[model samples]
Target: MGEVIRVAVVGKGGSGKSTVAGTLSRLVARQGRKTLALDSDPMPGLALSLGLGHITEPMLTAAVEKDLNGRWQLKKGIGGARAVSQFSIEGPDGVRFLQFGKADELGLGTMFASVSGFGQVVHRIAEDGVLSDWSIIGDLSAGTRQTAYDWAPYADTYLVVVEPTWKSVLTGRRIVRLAEQRGAEHIHLIANKIESNGDLDVIEERMDLAARCVISRDPMVTTADAAGVALIDHAPESSAVASIASLAEGLEGD
Candidate 1:
């Protein structure tokens, strides 16, 4: 409703959530909209997927500290979200990339602490309008489990990516419910890997999916992943990239 909007790409593991989030943000940025892309997944890959290579610093370790009680706390109080902009890495197509946290050899405890602490970061930016001046897109962690950490409040709109698989549909359905329960302003389904028109029909039969856009399976995505480049840059003419760009173009002036 303002100059900026927050959109989150969420789904089960291997649903191409990062791909959709990365390319969609790129397109949005190319349309002259200032955009910031945040990777909230513990195992983040949006940087490489977005053609920005890898970001070495994770958001958790970047903004938090351990207290004497051995509890993780925000190092900078409520200003943490605003500070994220100061340190964001430059991403392709004018979109800045930030991270929630990444765990390389870190144990689950540290990862969960990041999860909990990042909930504060998300809530700060989401509701406080810290990032409201720019189009904020988040690549959320796999599964609906993020809802447990109060993460659903971060997005005004939820783009649930569903592959043409039974497990994907079931998981997407759960995500839809969680998004609704958390009071998301809008919920849209984006169907991926649509090899044929029947795939949409099959998905529709299993669930009432009002798909916002159907992205067909394109090998360019695989090629881009293999070569470590953004598909928008590697294969701009690819059907997948073109369709997603069109979708982002429509959002201009909204």
Candidate 2:
């Protein structure tokens, strides 16, 4: 592993972006690096994928407060590094987790404080310089909203995970265009859930870009998802996990 890995996993809903984000974080941590897994989705998916399993409370809720202007902001003295140490939940392989509060029946209104706080922390970490050695893998909300909003300032690379579906391809295309607009140094289309030999080709042709990595459509992945278990824990030897591991290796070398 050479340079630190800072990437955001983005894609259409159900394209397995969370799986890639969580698995990649753990893989990088296993290599003796401090990895931070960020889940920006209000309805989180990374917690389960990271094997933390259904974190009921928002991790950053305590790290934010309403200032005199009545807006949410990170509390004084809680910078990025301290936020990670105090607020981030530890997962398997020493991967640290942070997420926006989950939206319940009341919706995102109840979680605005945590959302604002998390956003501040993300921005702070990118500029902090102290956490430069940390590997950051953020799983942005599915689709292009996060990319358009620049939620991942820390990512030099954007891993746009695309499945072999027309809808997914279009979403990935939009994200790629957005990332490019944001001046991302490296934007790679990761072909996920490939079932047949031509699956990768379909995605590449539709997107008009070569996939940097291809993950097979392993049945074990579906099973694990249904059971709400992490793919690496449920099927460590599965081909999909192996592909993700290889993806981690390639990113580490870069």
Candidate 3:
């Protein structure tokens, strides 16, 4: 792996994918890498985990314009680098954040332009050579829709987060299969919320794939959630954050 690791964190909802994505982004930035944390959930999950609570605005809406064919694009000169400098929000540890807008009471209809803008931006980042050395961490929406629709073109590696529950295992397996089908270079299972060796065993046995890393089920995670802050901010020395830090190190150092 190079200094820049483009990763998409995918899994079932509530399986702790956001936690892993947010923490890993901050840790990588702390290692002196330019890290961009992306939230394409449209449900305001990743922002809360990244400690940028309740970012409801459609940040990408201004960066895009309709072409002669009425197709949305990144304007005339707006590429990945410019988009980050202009639209992304800065968070703790110098990690930049970009997000697709949250759905209002009118459903996704309200932020349709932002959603289209986000799609174009991600694909542009993957294709553009300008940000070759910047790390990109994307937290995809829950379940298989985004994975099936090719939402994460920038991710050469897909980290499928799985819990001990059977549902989470099934979703993780489906995501792995989807990534393989798309010719992903690397796909790793990240066993999350592990309470013991038995939990890890059960996850691996059920998924039939060994995890590259395991994040322990720590009370600090719950504490951080209750406090509405990032895990790194709430308890940097906790077991869960330590595991995530190790995951970041292993990925970036590879």
Candidate 4:
């Protein structure tokens, strides 16, 4: 086995992509696999969903960029090697959380310059012989352009999350095409908020994507979000959590 399996969850906004990504991180970590969930959404939804409210710092990619461009040095003694360690927060389930802070006008130039360096860091993290030996799961923004430009190079598998709606399905197709163009190895689909099995069939037929799993709508998930807790921790027995666990298992198989 390699050091880590890098997975990126991407979909249209409001398609429950971050929820699934957060749940998948917890589920994978619970299986004794060290996991690092990177919130690349820029909106900071994953942190709230994962119950990590105290993480005020930005992710290593953005922070390091800020440092390199002379904006601000986040860590005092940390360099590239200690980059991941500095930004990642230890979760109760042993999953490390890294959230990319919102980009501002001044931060964008530094971010672009830091892209290559960030790629190197991600490669080192994903390659064998690391101490942490954790899988990297990223919750990226909804669009295909951002997924391709910002995340695809680092991800081994791109999990295209979609709902039963027409807009979501179309976005899934666009994501699949963009991921393929970006040289992603495997692209998987996980339909969320499904009301019925027929919806899954329709999505598969319409999008012609391999539906790995379908996560049903759960009121417990809503309640957990309202209460500001991770769905996996708040409602482990919920159908949505179970479905995310199944998705994690499938990714492990791959």
Q: What is the lDDT of residue 183 in candidate 3?
A: 84
Candidates 3 and 4, the one with greater lDDT: 3
Where is model 3 more than 4 Å wrong at Cα? Answer: 68-70, 105-110
lDDT of 3 at 220: 96
Predicted candidate 2 versus true structure: per-residue lDDT over 16-67, tens digit per residue: 9999998898888888898899999867689999999988776787888888
Evaluated against the true structure, the overall lDDT of model 4 is: 0.73
Candidate 2 Cα misplacement greater than 4 A, ranges: 105-109
Higher-scoring candidate on TM-score, 2 or 4: 2
Residue 98 error for model 3, in Å? 0.4
Best by lDDT: 2
Candidate 4 off by > 4 Å: 1-3, 59-80, 103-132
The stretch of ten residues in a row with the least summed lDDT in candidate 3 is: 104-113
> In order, how many clashes per candidate?
0, 0, 1, 0
Residue 228 Cα positional deviation in candidate 1, in Å, after optimal superposition: 2.0
**Predicted structure with the largest TM-score when compared to the true one:** 2
lDDT of 4 at 242: 83
